[model samples]
Target: SQTIHQWPATLVQPVGSPLSLECTVEGTSNPNLYWYRQAAGRGLQLLFYSVGIGQISSEVPQNLSASRPQDRQFILSSKKLLLSDSGFYLCAWTAENYGYTFGSGTRLTVV
Candidate 1:
């Protein structure tokens, strides 16, 4: 009975502004969490991932950073946003024999 939750389903951020998105998984233990971004009409791009607490791996060197504060909580942050950062952000967790489960997602638009 595990579920993933992502906050701020949608966001409109200005250029050069700070941004923070949160994701948390419930009813699971030591799950693999990941952050992905998808541009309009494009395939998803992996941003970051964590196999365990305090262990994060960045897929691309962009204007984004991720952290796993608690065992089931993950955070994505940016000091200064860019126009290219606008996309659909997704938080997912790998389940045992259930594949990957995703959150409701957050659509960020940078103007």
Candidate 2:
């Protein structure tokens, strides 16, 4: 079975601080990885996606960035976090629309 893991589960950061969130998958190979941000009014936004290592695509331009340096590892990073960046961050993987398995998710609260 395949599974995804994300942490630190929840986060509280001040505006203009740095941010880093890690996600990894188990039991799958070469899966397409995606990073999504769920804001209150904005709905779900695709921040980045990677079909393979070193191949990242950004769907929206904001304070978020994503990287896939390993086949099963994905990371979301921000040098300067914003209050608007506060929301739910999710990592998901898909096998051609068969479906996406999301991580536990991170509730980021920025002030």
Candidate 3:
């Protein structure tokens, strides 16, 4: 069975700190990876997507970045955190003919 894992489930950071979140998928090969953010009441926003290793597409220009180190691992990082960067971060993967499988998200709060 394929599964996606994302962590740490929650975080609270001071302003200007660094941030790193990780996600990995198992039981699948070469899946399309994605990062999304959901605010308190807003809709889900697509932050990044990767079709293959080292191929990342970012949809927004917020203070965040993503990387794909291997076929099944995706990482999200930030050099410095901002107060507005607080939100729920989600990692998901999908392949042809299959719906997206999402991991447990990370809720980040910067103060």
Candidate 4:
């Protein structure tokens, strides 16, 4: 019965702004948390992942960072966002054999 929660549903920001999105899980322990981005006319790409508390692995280095302050709490942050950051922000997690599930996602529009 694990579930993921993401906030704001949608956002609109200008170029060179700061961004922060939060995701949290319930009904699981030591889950693998991931942040992915899906751009228009492009496929999904893994940005960051956390295997446990305070253990995060970055798949790419850009204008983004991730953190896991608690077992089930994951946060995505950026110091100064770029126009390229405009895309769908999805939070996902996978179980041992249950596969991966994603959140509702935050549709970010940067102008």
Candidate 5:
């Protein structure tokens, strides 16, 4: 009964505005967590990942940062969002013998 919760489902923000997206997993422990961004019709780009609490790895350099303060909680944040930062954000988690399970995702639009 593992599940990932992500929000908000959609957002429209002005450029230079701060942003925060959160994801949390239930019924799992020490899962490999990830943040991915998918531009319109583009492939999924890995943003950040964590194998354990307080251990975050950035896959690409961008205005965004990620943190895993708890074993099942992951947060994505941006101090000032850029126009190019708009996209579909997904949070996913996987464990040994389990394929990745993604949350519903957040569609962001930077105006």
Candidate 6:
């Protein structure tokens, strides 16, 4: 019974404000974690991923960063957010046989 938890289902922030989003998994260990962003009607865009604790991979060049501080914990952070960064943020994870499970997602609006 593995589950992923993501916080702050919706957010509205001013331009250039700091951002922090967290995702954690239960009943799983060392799962591949990912951060994705989806625009209004566009497909999902991979932002970052982690294979293990302290190991992170960036899929695109942007103003965002991710870190895996624990085996089942992943965090996304930005020193300053941009208006272009506004979107639906999703946290997902997958194990050996289990398919990707995603969080409810956070809708971020930047003004």
Using TM-score as the measure, the top candidate is 1
Clashing pairs in 6: none
Candidate 4: stretches off by over 4 Å: none
Worst 10 residues of 2 by lDDT: 95-104
Q: On residues 70-107, what C-alpha lDDT tens digit does candidate 2 reach at each position?
A: 99999999999988999999999995557988998999
Error of 3 at 26 (Å): 0.2
What's the lDDT for candidate 4? 0.92
Kindly report which residue pairs in candidate 2 clash with one another. none
RMSD of 3: 0.9
Pick the winner on lDDT between candidates 3 and 5: 5
Predictions in order: lDDT: 0.96, 0.91, 0.94, 0.92, 0.96, 0.93
Name the candidate, 3 or 5, with the larger TM-score value.
Answer: 5
Task: State in Å the error of residue 89, model 5.
Answer: 0.3
Candidates ranked, most accurate by TM-score first: 1, 5, 6, 3, 4, 2
Q: Which residue pairs show backbone clashes in model 1?
A: none
* Candidate 4, 1-111: lDDT as tens digits: 888999879999888888999999999998999999999888999999998999999998899999999999899988888888999999999877968889999999989
> What local lDDT score does residue 95 receive in model 2, on the 0 to 100 scale?
58
Listed in order, each prediction's TM-score against the native is 0.97, 0.93, 0.96, 0.95, 0.97, 0.96
What is the RMSD, in Å, between candidate 1 and the native fold over all Cα?
0.8
Residues 1-109 of candidate 6: C-alpha lDDT, one tens digit per residue: 8899998899999999999999999998889999999999999999998999999999999999998999999999999999999999999998667688998898999
Any runs in candidate 3 off by more than 4 Å, and if so which?
none
Where does candidate 1 have its weakest 10-residue lDDT segment?
A: 95-104
**Per-candidate RMSD, Å:** 0.8, 1.4, 0.9, 1.0, 0.8, 0.9
10 residues in a row with least lDDT, candidate 4: 94-103
